[model samples]
Target: MRLSVWRIKYTQRSCSFLRSFHRSFAAAAAAGDDGKGCGPGVSLSDLRRAPACSGPLPALKPTDSHTVLIRTDLLRPGKAPEPHPSPDQLQDRWDDTHVKLPCSEHNLFPTDRTTDQRPSKALSVFLQGLQGSEAQHMFGELLSAMAQLALRAPRLLTQPIPLLRTQRCRSITLSQEQVSCLLANAFFCTFPQRNSHQTEFSNYPDINFSRLFEGSSQTKQEKLKTLLCYFRRVTQQRPTGLITYTRQCLQRLPSWSSSEKQFGKLHISCEGSIEDQGYGMLQVDFANRFVGGGVTGSGLVQEEIRFLINPELIVARLFTEALNDNECLIVTGAEQFSRYSGYSDSFRWEGDHDDQTPRDEWQRRCTEIVAIDALHYSQFLEQFRPENMSRELNKAFCGFVRPGVQPENLSAVATGNWGCGAFGGDKRLKAVLQMMAAAEAERDLMYFTFGDADLVKDCVHVSRLFLVGSVFRLLLQYYECVCKKTTRSRPQKTLYSFLSELL
Candidate 1:
C-alpha cells in the first residue's frame, strides 16, 4: 500500500515537470514562428559588403577548390548528407583561409605560403579514418554549412581575428550563428597543427576535433552524440541571442612580498560544481599550460569537460599563448549548451542545459571564467618549496584581479581543489594559496569542494585562522624561513599548523 502511494506521487511530480517543460517549449516555438522576418533562411546574397566600385562588381569565378553549400531543406528525411571535396583534395594549410570564394579568395587569402602554412601529416591519418563512417557525412555537411554562412558575411571570421597581433585583451560578442560557424571549422579540423607530444605546437592548446574522429571507443560515440545534438539545435532554431568571449591577461604581476592585509570575502560549499554554482561569477578552470589542455586529445577532467560543453572556449587557444605559472586566462560570455554527470573517465553527457543566466550590456550571458594552471608535482613532497608556493600565489593573483573595474563591482572567484585531482596538489595548500591571492586582489571567493565533507570542516577552521589579524604577516615570515632553511625543524607541516603556532 505504501509503495503504491509513493509510485503515484512520483508519477504526478514527473507529469507536472513535463507539463511545465512543454509550456516553455511551446512558448519558444510560438515566438520563433511569428512571421516578423524571423524565417529559417538568412538573406545571404543581400548581405554583400558595400562596394568601392565605380560601376558593377564582377561575378564570382569558379575556383580549383569547389564551393559546397549545405541547405537545411536539402537534407533527406532519413539519409545522411553526401560528402564534398574528397579528403584527399583537402590539402590543409594553416594560413590558407578555409573559405575560398572568387571575390574574397585572392584578396583575403594570403598568396605566399609561409612556414605557418605547413600542412599537418597527422591530419591526413584522421581524415582518411573517417572515410565511410557516419561522422564523415556529418562533418562534410557542417563544413559546407560553415562555408555558406561565412560567404554571407566575411566579418564573422575576419574581424576579432584569431592571430592576436596585439597583446591587449579583447572582448567580442558573437551570435549563435557565428559560434556555429566557428565550431564547424573546429569540427572539420581546420585549425593549425596540434600534436600532444610534439614540441613545435606544444605551447598552444589542442583545438581541433581530430581526437573525436581518431578513436573508435564508446566515449567517442557518446561525445559525437552530444556534439550533434548541439549542431541540430543551433541549425534548427537559429538562436538570436549573443555570447561574449573576453580574453583577460595580467600585464603587471602582483608583488608577493607585500604584507598588506586586505581581507576579501569567501564562501565554502561542500557540494556542487564550479560551473553550476559559479554561473555569473568568474569561475576557475584548473587548466593546462596550453589552455584547453588535453581536451581534444586523451584528457577528460574538470577543464576538458568544461571545454566539451562550452566548446566555444576551445577557440581561445588560437589567440592565447601558453600560460606561464604567473599568468591565467579569463573567458566571459560562454553559454553552457549541455550538462554532464561524473568526472574524468566517468564523465557522461546528460543532456541539453537551458542557460537562464541574464545577459550583460554587451548582449553576452553574465558568465565569466578564469583558467589558471597549477603546478603539477610529480613527487608528493615537491610542492612544499616556498618558491613553488609563491609561484602559485602569483598565478592566482593574475586570475583574481579585474583590471580597471571598481573593487565593489568585482565578482567573487568560484574555485576549489583546483589541482588536487590530476596535478596531485595538496588541497588544503591550494585553498590557502587561493585565499591569499584573493585577499591581495581585493576580490571575494566562493570555493566548491564537490561533496567533500571533511574539507568543509577544514575550510571553515582554516579560513577562520586566515581571517585573523597578522595572519598574512606571519605567513610571509614563515615562507621566508622555509626559503632560508632557517626553520626550527625539518618536519613537514600543514599551512594551518604553521599559522596555529604563530597565533
Candidate 2:
C-alpha cells in the first residue's frame, strides 16, 4: 500500500514539472528580447549564429578499420579516389623503385648561395627546442617533401602525394602567411630514406647498408633490456617481463593552432638549411586546409599522386656504396656529423648503421645510411663548409640527385596539402606562392633559382609515404567491408572479415 502511494505521488510531481516548463517556454516565446512582446515573432537567427554542434562535430571515417579518430565536420572536399591497392599492387610498386637518372645533370639552386656566411647565433639553438620532441621526426617529413617533388616529377604523372605533419593549432589558425614563410625559409639540405636506393624495398637488410630496424634479432629478454637502457631507467624484473619507455597518452586540453607569431610575423626562415652534398631543391607553399586527392578527415586518410616524370631522369642515392651500377645510392645520417671541418667514419663508417666496404668508391660514398640527412632539420648548423653545404643542397634538391632507372609513369600520394586547394584554385600554387613572396627576398637569386633546382631526395619520405598510402588503401577496403557487414544489428562476415583485425 505504501509503495503504491509513493508511485502515484512521483507521477504527479513529474507531470507538474513538465507543465511548469511548458508554461515558461510559452512566456519566453511571447516576449521579445526586451521582454515586452513589442517585436514581431522572433527569428531563430540567434540560435543559427551559435557555434555549430557545441563541441566538435563527428569526424568522417573512410572505413571501419582505421585505428585513428576522425571527425566528419573536419572533412575536406576531394576526389572520390580509386580503391586502395592490394598487397600485390603495393609489392609491385615497391619493386618499381630503380636508379634511372641520366649521368649528366645541372645545378638546381641559385649560383649565389656559394658565398653564404655563418650566423652570429646558430642552427643548434633554433633546433634546441625541437630535439627529441615529438616534432623532431619532422626532419624526415621535410626531406621527403623535397625529394618526392623532384624525383617523381609529379607534373609528369600528375600524381598528388599528400604531405601530413602534426603542428600546433595556433600555428595553423593564427597566421597563414607565417606558415608560408616557414616553408619558404626551410631550405632543402638532405633526403634520407630506407631501402630507397635499392630496386626493391625490404624490411631486411643486405650486406651493403647496415640495417637498424631490420636484420637484428635479440631474445625477448634482451629486447627488454635494450628498451630499459634506451629509456635510461631501471625497473623490477617482474614475472611477466621487462618494462621500458612505455606510457599512456593522457589528453587533457584542447589543441591550439600551428602558426608561430615569430615566424609568421618576421616572414623569414632563420631555422637553417641542411645542404651537405650535391643536387636537389624543393618548391613549397603556404596553404589553409588541404585534403589533396582524397578525403582526410574520414576513416583511412589518403591522397593520389599523378606525376609523369621520365624514369631515366631521376637518380637514386644509396645509403651505402652501390651494390651494382643499377643499385641506387642513398645518403643517410652524416658519416661523421659535426659543426666544423670534416669528420671521419674510421675505416668502416659507424653510428646508427655502418656501411663498411673496401671499394674506393665506398670511401666517402653517402650510401647505406638512413635518409634523415636528405632534408633533416638538424640541431647542429656549423658543420659543413659553405662549399660542401652548397654541394649537398644542390645534389639532393636538383633533378639529377639520384640518377637511375625508373618507369615513365612515376607519381606520389599521401595526406598533406597545405591548403593550396583551399586558398587559391591551382595545383601549382606552391610554386606560384614562392614566386609571389620570396622571389624578391633573394635579390640576385631571383634570376638564378628555378623550382626544379631545389629538391631533397628522402628515403624516409618515400617509405613513410608508401606506408601512408597503403594504410589509406586498406581503409577504403575497410569502409566497403563495414557497409556490407551490418544488416540491422548483426555482423555479416565476408572473405575479408578478418582483415580489419589488425593494427
Candidate 3:
C-alpha cells in the first residue's frame, strides 16, 4: 500500500480520537467562567521589538577534538582539492562510529532488478531533467556539473562522520559543496545499512531516499520537485559557506522553583511564519525525539516542512542520534532553497527560493535553527503533571540557554505553538513555559501565534501581569487542583482560567 494512503487513514483516525478527547474537556469546563478578562492595557503592536537585544556573534571556530570537518581544504575559498589518498590513508578516515560511505570500495551500490546496476528511476528522472538547451540555460551545463560532483565525492568525503552520541557534546562542520555531494549520494539511495529493518545504525533516523520515492501522494511529487530544484541550483553554482551541526547536552537541570528570572521582552503576532519573519534569529524546530520526524516518510508538520525547504537540515539525520530530555540540536548556515505553501495534507511546493541571508565571519549563514522535542502525552492531563512540566521547561532551556555566551549576546528566540498540534499540547501553557525558558536564558522572544488572535491577547495580557516565578507557582497550584478532582459533577477550570481568576 502507498505510504500516503496509510498516512491519510492514520490522520483521520487521530483526528477522530482528538475530537472525542476535546469534547470530554469541554464537557468538564461547560459550567466554568470564560476567563476572557484582560489585564491593564496591552496590545500586539506594543510588544513588537520592544527593548530589542543585539550583540556580537559568538566566535565559532572548529575545534579539532570535538569537531569533524569533511573536506578541510574546502573551508578556504578558491582552494584546490587535495591529492587523492592511498588505501591505508583512506582506511584511517573511517571508523565503526562514523557513517559508512556508499562510495567506499567495500560498500558500493548494489544492483537491483529494476535499474540493473544503473542509477534508480528516481535518480535517472532527476538527472534527465538536467539535459538540453533549456536546462543548460537554467542550470549552466548541470549534467557536466553533476559528473564533476560524482568525481569529487570520494575525495571530498575522506573523513568519517562521527555520530553525535547522547550525553556528549560534538559538532560536524562541512562545506556546502560537501553537503551537496553527500545528498547526491543519498538521492541515489547509496547509503548502506540505512534501509534495512535491523541494522547497526537502527538508532539513527533513515538517511536513504528510497521511502521518499515510494509514496504516491502529491506531497511526494512536489517534494521531489523541490529537492531536484535544490540540486539544479547548487550544481549551477556551488554554495561557498560552511554549515555546522552541534549536539548540545545539559549536565545540570535548572531549579525552576527557585529561579528568580522575570519575563523577557516578547513580540507577539498573529501574522507571518518563523522562517519568513524570524530570519537571523534562533528559530525553534518542534521536533520528534527521532529528529527530522517522518520527513523520510509521509509525516508532514513543522519539522518536515522546514527540512523540505532548507534540505541541508535533513542531512543532520545522517549522524545525529535521537534527542534526550536534556539535549537539543543546533544547525547553523543552512540556506533555504525552495518556497512552499499550505501545510501537512494541503502542502504544496511553490518552486524556488533565492536565499540571500548573509554569511557570518566563519563563512556560515547567519540563520540558526535549534531542534528540541517536547514530551508526547498519551492523555491531555498528563502534561500538567509537575514532572512533565519540569521536563519540558528543561528541554526548552536546553535549546535556548547559551552556556559560553554572555547574556547580552543571546539572540531573540523565534517560536510559535511548539508541540501543540499532533502532540496535544495546550497553547497557553506552552507559551508561558517557553516565555519562562527564554527569560532564564536571558534572550528576548518573538512568538508567532500562526493567526491565533486569542492566544496573542492571552499571552500578552498574562505576560504583562506576572513574573516567571509567579506563573510557575500558579501552574503548580492549578495542576494540583485539576489532578485531585474526584467527581465529574464538579466544574473544572482550565489553566488560563485558573490563572486569570487569581491574578
Candidate 4:
C-alpha cells in the first residue's frame, strides 16, 4: 500500500514536465529563436562594423549568420551599463583615415590565391574518434583536434570579423557558481610558511589537492595563456550580459569577519587591508596537488609559479551576487593572467562595467621577474608534456571530462541551418552533427572546442591576444593596484612585487 502511494506521488510530481513536453518539446538549441525582426525566408548579411556615419542604420535582413535574434538590448536596463572604450570607437592610426583594418594590424587577411587552402588532416582524424556516450568520453581528443586545426587550410580555419574578435561561452548552461569554480580550479596556489615560535599564530592552512591536467610541459607564461583560453571559453555558454566583464570586489566579506575560525584556521599572512583574508590555504593545497596529477612538489615549480602568480585565490564562498555577476567576472581573465605570469600582456576595450573595487590602485602594486616575447612563448610547452605535447593535451583534457559528467545541455550541429538559419529544435540537431562529421571526414579537418583557431588568428586573434597581453602589461605597470587605492603623504610600497623572484 505504501509503495503504491509513493509511486502515485512520484508520477504526479513528474507529470508537470510531461504536460510541458506535450505542449511543446524543448528547443534543442535554446537560442535559435532570433525573432526580433527577422522573418521567414529572409537571409542575414554579415554584421557591419560600428559605423562612423551619424545616420540611423537599416533593419537586419534575415540570413544564416545574422538570422533572427531577440534584440537583447530591448530587455529593460538592469543598471546603467558601465561604458568602457570600445575598439570600434577608438582613434584610427595617425597615418591614414580611409580603407582601414577592423583591428590593429591591416595586413591580416590573405589576398593571394584560393588554391593555397588545404584541409586540416589532424582535425579530421581527431573528430572521427570523438564518438560514444559520455560514460567513456575524453576531452583531450578535442584539444588535439584544435591544435592540429591550426595547420589546416586558412579559409576553413579563418573566421568572419565579429565572430573572430569576441570570446563567449559556446553553449549556455553553466551558472556563475560553475564559472567561478572553474576559475578557482585554474588558479595557481600558494601557502604561507609556518614559523617555529608561533604554535598557532597564522590561521592559513596547508595547500589542497588538484586533478592533474595533462599537456606538454609549458613555461609559466604559456601555461597561464592556454589555461586562460579554457576558462574564458567555458564562460561563453549562455552568457548573461551581466557577466560580460568580471570586476574586482576587494571589500571584506562579513562571514569571514567573525573572529572564530571554523574549517581549520586562516592566517592573516599579508598584512594590511589589501586582501579580505590572507589565504584560503587548505583549499589552495588541494588545487595544487590536483594540477600535478595528484602528485606533490615538482622541485622549483611551486616556487616559480607562486612567485609569478597569486597562488592564493580569494576564498570562494557560495555567495554569488546575482545582480553583480557580470562586473565580478568582467576583468577576471585579466586578473588571473596578471596574477601568476607577472607578465601582464592582457588588453581589452574597457566598457562601462565597474564595481566598488578600486581597480587601478589595487593592481599596480605587483611586478614580475622574467618578461617574455612572442616567439619564445610557444616554445615553453615541452616541460608539461611527457612525450608528444599535443597528444598529452588530448589525453589529460579528455580524462577531466571522461567520468560521469555529461556535456550538459549541449546541442549538436544543425544541417539545414548550414550557411542559413538554425536547423533548430527538430531532430535536425543530430543530423547536422553527422553532416559536419561527414564533411570533416572528406577533408581530414575538424572544427571543435571553441572552433577554428586559424580563422580566429587572422580575423580575431590579434585583438583578443592584445587584450590578454594588456592585462599582464598593466600588472607590471601597477603592481601597486593590488595594494588598493593609497594616497598617503609618503610614497607607498609596490604591491605586486610578490612576483619579483620566481616566474
TM-score of each: 0.67, 0.15, 0.81, 0.19
Cα RMSD to the true fold for all candidates: 19.0, 29.7, 10.8, 28.8
lDDT order, best first, reads: 3, 1, 4, 2
Q: TM-score order of candidates, best first? A: 3, 1, 4, 2
Query: Which candidate's TM-score is highest?
Result: 3
Q: Lowest lDDT 10-mer window, candidate 2? A: 305-314
Tens-digit lDDT track of model 2 for 328-403 = 1222111211112111111111112122211111111121121111222222221122232332223222211222
**Candidate 2 segments whose C-alpha is farther than 4 A from its true place:** 1-65, 68-210, 213-266, 269-503
| Tens-place lDDT digits, model 4, residues 1-503 | 95467446545643443343233222212312543111211111211111111123234222332211122233222321211122233433312211111122443434322212222333234324445652133234433333332222121111221110111211111112223332332232211111112423122222211211222222322333334343333233322221212212212221211112111000111111111111110011111111221121121232223222222132111111211111121111112222322222231212221222211111211111111000111322221122222222122122111122132211111111111112111111111222222222111111121222332222111111111122222222232233234454222442122222111
After TM-score superposition, the amount by which residue 134's alpha carbon in candidate 3 deviates from its true location, in angstroms, is 7.6
Q: Which segments of model 4 are wrong by more than 4 Å? A: 1-5, 24-334, 338-503
lDDT scores for all predictions? Answer: 0.58, 0.21, 0.74, 0.22
Give the per-residue lDDT of model 1 (tens digit) for 149-235: 434334344332333222445444445555666666566554434434453454455555666566555455556556655765666
Where model 3 places Cα greater than 4 Å from the true spot, the runs are: 1-65, 68-94, 108-151, 486-491
- Measured by C-alpha RMSD in angstroms, how accurate is candidate 3? 10.8
Candidate 1 weakest ten by summed lDDT: 45-54
How close to the true structure is residue 227 of candidate 3, measured as C-alpha lDDT?
Answer: 79
Best by lDDT: 3
TM-score of 1: 0.67
